[model samples]
Target: MPAPNPACASNKTEPSMLADSIDALLPQTQCRKCGFNGCLPYAEAIARGEADIDRCPPGGDAGIAKLAELLGIAAKPLNPAYGIERPRLLAIIDEDACIGCTKCLPPCPTDAILGASKHMHTIIADLCTGCELCIAPCPVACIAMVPAPNLTWTETDADRARLRHLAKQQRLTKLEAEKAERLQRQKQLLSKAKSAKNQD
Candidate 1:
């Protein structure tokens, strides 16, 4: 479909911005459940009026309504081409039948698999969000989706380390921006105070 023109919404705020916000709430599985490349870009199209809000199966009805509200558009029925959302599942490797091509490793979003090349790999079920982002990447078809294991399943330190690092970076950026704003405010206050003193 051709993209929505900026004039599509009469409201001051453009639809693209609201669509981006809605996209952020979606799972980044790239499953095409929404019939888009990924959640982020689809959100832009939806925001811009190029796509329907009901296309995302993962978001279901709730997502569609939320997007409509955000964009000031009417809520509509979901498009069935995307398929229904299912419960979380993890890809499991049948160890005996496995020929370790290691193709699955690169595609795993959470780094749930553990093994070297030409060696058997195992899925870390706990870390898996059942996004199914890993399935098509496996050339062997050895990977099968099973119910995700319970809470006891754990990811290695590497995963935790990376997550923490990214979080800390974000926090630092926020703090820095706040500090700069505070300093600017203080400078303005001091200048105003001096001006008043001079007038006195």
Candidate 2:
């Protein structure tokens, strides 16, 4: 018989262990501005009652406040040692200035930069999450986040509502594609079964 699923193994008896498990589920961005080794370790520290909730910069005020509620602690100011939260951005590379030393490439979590050493590199704007992780590593400082102009706020409620509507439609399209893939797989399985029966 196959071994039991790892997820099915019990942590039910240990409530603290359950919290640690929850902490482990967080994205591990090792930016310690969280006042810990990384998000997970800070989360684990919070789970274990060893750290305050307001230390995570990436999580920002919302995350800290949520953790405070979860742990029955008062929500406090974000620790100043960790940097302030910045608006989301897409990094643009100045191709003319980019020598492509590749120092910046290692820091980008999304692999958005394209080019080789000693050549011009460009950012794939669509792929960049604008985490600002790449800005520090650039030897030439050619990459910088500029707010995407298309998303800039307009004075009209109609435009804002329209943008939301478009985003919803895109999400629906993605869901439909996933549903179609599932149906296609089911059809293929049925066809294979019918052929096997005929052969038998």
Highest lDDT scorer:
1
CA-RMSD of model 2: 12.2
TM-score, every prediction? 0.62, 0.54
User: Which pairs of residues collide in candidate 2?
Assistant: none
For candidate 1, write residues 92-162 as lDDT tens digits: 88877667888876555556678888898887765554556667877767778876655222224224423
Candidate 2 at residue 16, lDDT? 61
Give the CA lDDT, 0 to 100, for residue 192 in model 1.
Answer: 100
lDDT of 2 at 116: 89
Model 2 misplaced regions, further than 4 Å: 1-32, 35-38, 48-50, 148-200
Please give the RMSD to the true structure for each candidate, in Å.
13.2, 12.2
lDDT of 1 at 46: 66
